[model samples]
Target: MLDLTKLAQQMQGMSQQLTLEATATRQRLELAEKLLSHAFSRQNKLTTHQQTWHDRLSFTAAEPVEPLNLRIAIPVPPAAHTVIATDGSQIAPSHHEIAYCYLINVGRIILHYGQNRLPLLDSLPEVFYRPEDLYISRQWGIRTEEWMGFRRTVSEAVVLGELGERIKDEGGGMRDEKRQNRETRNQRVEAVASFHPSSPIPHPPPHPSSPIPHPSLAMVDGSLIHWFLEPLPGEARDRILPPVLAAWDQLRTNRIPLVGYVSASRSGEMVNFLRLQACPYDTPDCMTHCSNQGDRSPCQVLDPLKDAALWATQLEPGQRSPLWRSSARILDLYGDHRIYFCYVHVGTEVARIEFPAWVAEDADLLDAALSLTLAQVQKGYGYPVALAEAHNQAVVRGGDRARFFALLEQQMIRAGLRNVGTSYKEARKRGSIA
Candidate 1:
């Protein structure tokens, strides 16, 4: 006998756990939908103005457009300035890759993403009143009356696929098995249609063994191109590059320096755990003792900041020790280079500031960049500035407060400082005593 009673109990427990998880997931998804809906609603109000500007820009199709060919040229107005960022990611089920090209200029932002075969203009809103249709089309590739029939099909397919995957992991359900079988059959039919030469559908070229040859385009003056490429075969490079460059030119009018930030570590718990894993040896040594390595020691190779701090205490001034040399060394070794600047303060959340590189050296430019970046961060991540000290520090001997203050003031003036007093007040109000 196959212990039917015990099996039934186990099955019931598993079902209950799954149901609870599904309920929680549903709640999270509902919340995400609400947020997205709110954002879309707000954006719809601005769409008319945006569309007017877009209409003013000329976008002529390339002559005798072949199937899967989409070429759009938008003129760069004189004195026009903008920053554009482009990124690509693969979608599941179909395994088709989509590229998102974002154009931001003077507080105006536009986002476009889809396959080349499905040009963005084809799906752009025809009626200003039906703006929500744009979001629906982008997400599910269906709109208006077509959506009523296709929406259920797409949603059911997604749900079934998810359910099939879960059943495969758990090793259960005849219904899931049947669904997977059906899906597999449908995929085979679609694959055949996709590969057929007679079919109108344009499919991505088969993965080539060699690297794709990237075509070089003449860079337009007063424009910057930031290209994020999908890993393509060598043979396909020539075909991909031109479209990428064309898209880049269409989006922006100025060369913006790309800058990113780096961080030593995130959560303190994670840092501590990583530190223990990185410990060189079990036995206590003089250097390790100085490092305050207790029961758990961090990985020295991974945590260069910890290493630098340790070595800083051990090494004397003007010492030839490589470990205590420069802050850049610590940053170079273990920093995450996605943001422009990492603000490090003991017992405070890490501040990752991302900005264009051109503004870095110029104080006035940096201030403007920081203001915009900080505002975005505050609105998104909810962080307030703690202090408005001069970026360049002056070390005064014998703790001369007056000299320090004078040097700080001079640097602030040189930097074309503003908003320092306000920032200080906000910090104080938030109980940041320091």
Candidate 2:
């Protein structure tokens, strides 16, 4: 029923629009493909770059430079040892919920490796929910959710530190009848805290000898350096740093070495060090390599490559990269516990391990920690077993979260507190007839 001329005009307009879009899209696709292809050319160059710079690459650190291609075999693990691993989990504030609060849970496990893979004492899911616990004040100067993640880590350290204190209190003795009578080589005293719903913190039980905790390596789940890096100046810094440092002090007082295990790290410290070698001569060469207009060298090409990727091919199973002091800024705060790192290959991927400067300074401590870590990795196939246990205990599931809120609601109603209801969206998700 439409006029033929009008219909023809409308079709012509549609065709023009489609043609313009196609032309623009085609150009964009061609440009993007060209750019992507050009980027790969650099990685190819690094793969073929001269091997001389690789020898003298480390300069920023005071320690001797380890060759980029160097790999050392892992030492044999001791016959019997203990690993105390601590891990943390958190639930950030949710709009679908009642209160403007977040919760953090820390899990710790102490395992002994001499007799029968015995696990001694473990603290599971210690929850925190205080006004001071919930949010970081504007004064902390940290943008990371009022330092929530940082606080969670600090809490984990605090718990471990408390354990160290208790060990000292008990004099590391097995004189207690419960520990003496236990059939298994490893004995456990389990106690967890819940401040809410009015639960009291339990006292430390008698020491279990299965895994003598003291003189053992205290392992934390993530990077020790990363947590200490949260920028808090003046009083804010003072407020947060003490708890972690105290934990370190306590563990060291008990003769326990601290080890931090990071799986699948995206750090570029190795790659950055390697870049120093790839530079033509000095700092200028390094700076020029990053410049857009400079002669694009292999140094520039290797920019996107991660240390994990570079070290993966260079390291063999059970072999480790040479130790290097971390150049991270936060390390300046750790007076005696300055951090050092090395990579260990577990037949699958290279995992980064970090330890204190004191641990590295002593030859025996370093070897003992590394050996124990490798033993755990071997048993676990790749991951450390103690860390695995800590993570398993710390993880807060969705169903568990729901039950927690339900319990909170029940207590709120009993106390005649104002009802805090969930959003309609959540209500619909919970029960929808349609």
Candidate 3:
């Protein structure tokens, strides 16, 4: 149990330390803001040096796709559009349990606006109890919890892709109906023109398909980078990344905007890029120049701040920063679906919004995606409604975990399994001890 009195006593010193850090952070933020203005003054030189030195840097740095200082107001989304989001929760395998097993529950939410359609919210749960499922590889000594977390991520992506496919199918049906109606009208016009050859069929009105009915978006609740796969062996990575890439491919091929929303992110990719700009060397190198300096280095002036700190001042509510190509090594395996990101100030906080390269390249799709994201945030009151709904469906409470184990024990007894029992610690905790 936590001792409140001791914690209370320690809070005094903690408060003092935090106050000191806050004062230091203010000075650093001022320096960073000035440094950013200085770097942008010679944008051409910064870009040239970054292009040349990006690969050599030891830290991850964002590659600018647009002017570094560019910030755009959020566009209005179409009246009728769909936003689908997926999230996942998992139960890790426990040694204290009667059975070595885990569960993954993926939540899916689809919200339609301006059409007055009811939203769709549901979850899909799968249980893994086999030995192969419990262990990734005995040789690699991979833990179940780590592997299971990645597995849950995969589940989230696959479910999001499935929802994307569903939306496409629904849209396709609508398109087919429109096509049939057009064909039927053309035939009637031909028939009427045949009876009166002098009258012409009004030239068929050029490109008759009214604008491609608002855009649809697919969203997942976290980073699309799959950073977890970075440390795994080639075989393990191979087993994990293919499905995720396939899911991204599905959205790209269908022209569906896909995004990963991260709220109040502490990432420093863009801040590291600023560090590159602050480097004194003509050709930037982290190991050779700044290796021994640690916090004393010139480039370390902004080390205390995250990317969000830098943008919070630059971006107003409903505005977003310019796109930057992520430097994650896992993205090299992403093919044409390489992840790109921008920071958006969504009233509540600065959020890191990541999407595939295809979405970033297209002007219309980019606007539509961000607009719909902003719309979702407004509707949900600071968070994306679809993602928020999905979280509600995905969350598993503490009581649910207890009941899960209880159900497993009962099922085992019904199946006549022998030597099935909880750990002594688990039993003692459950038993009365006063």
Candidate 4:
């Protein structure tokens, strides 16, 4: 017989813990609300964050306008353009399985739109299986990290590069079959034009003026800078550099602008900027002098309000902030490909968009890149449809994961390796007690 008094005591303890957690959460929220109010009130007064914080911060960001205006909007995308988006999905090495293997599945989309309202979508998916593919060098000692995800992301960019190459080819696959048959090419083009304004793609004897090529934009699903691409201690940069460099080379050679689109980012670059603004002029450097951690930092009054929080109300749909340079550790190695970023309003949310400094320097390419991205936002109703579609193609659903394991087991049986077995824990999870 259990003691009723003990049970009551335990329940009371649980309730007390819950109450404490709730109080702490509320305190955090109140601090956030306070900072947000201050930011909004001082938006106009807090200009020049870049000048003060540029050297101290690992990354830099700026509002497009000094006074924090809310009515700004970017122009509509050019009449026609191409957008290629790539996303990665993976299955980690499962302890439940016999083999120490993992898989990386990549989804790629090629979208061309403009004269036609509907986008023509072409998708490709690839799977990788190799020892090198499954594991990174042991010096960093992180076997559990998803190295394959990074590899797939690099490969995804390669996909865009290849497509761009094909399109740029004088007589490549992008060249329409009908156009090759010179006798009836004109007639076919007219027929396609009459029947389907959008269908007549991949061929044009030549566009009248400067043809806006199909690969004007290549979009990545996440931040381009990641640990895998960065220099690790004791690991030779030579081994890790070629693929990423080649991928960037491919995009550049084809004159395709690449963007690393980050949705719902909580990056603190803007917060650091705000902190720098709050620094007392008397202090040479506040970060060192005022090294208080957490809510105790002198700038903690501005705690928890990220760039997204500050600009969510300020940026109108399709509007974007001025570009910022990233001084992140990995970017230090990027050489001529230093990344620049801006916050763009996609209607549903404010997102961080990053591109190479090259795009920022080239006015024409920058405009084209922005227009292409904004059009995607409109087409997808606040989110880029190409990114959405690529994610759909790349995502590894639970059912598919189970099916893949089943297929692997079946293949093992066929190869006379039926003796292979899974952990009892895995079997129990499958159906053991249920």
* Best candidate according to lDDT: 3
Q: lDDT tens digits, residues 276-350, model 4?
A: 445565432545665455356565555555777656655777788756666566776787787877788887899
lDDT at 403, model 4 = 79
Q: What are the TM-scores, per candidate, against the unseen true structure?
A: 0.22, 0.71, 0.89, 0.74
Model 3 per-residue lDDT tens digits across residues 222-306: 7778787888898888878999888877777667889888887889988888887688887787777778877788877787689
- Local distance difference test, each candidate: 0.27, 0.64, 0.81, 0.64
Number of residue pairs clashing in candidate 2, backbone atoms closer than 3 angstroms, sequence gap of 3 or more or interchain: 0
Model 4 misplacement above 4 A:
1-72, 114-130, 170-215, 227-231, 234-241, 282-284, 292-295
Candidate 1, residue 201: the lDDT equals 30
**Which of the predicted structures, 3 or 4, would earn the higher lDDT when compared with the native?**
3
Please list the Cα RMSD from the true structure of every candidate, rounded to 1 decimal place. 32.6, 10.8, 8.4, 7.0
User: What is the model-wide C-alpha lDDT for candidate 4?
Assistant: 0.64
Model 1 CA RMSD to the hidden true structure, in angstroms: 32.6
Residue 149 in model 1: lDDT: 25
Q: Which ten residues in a row have the lowest lDDT in candidate 4?
A: 166-175
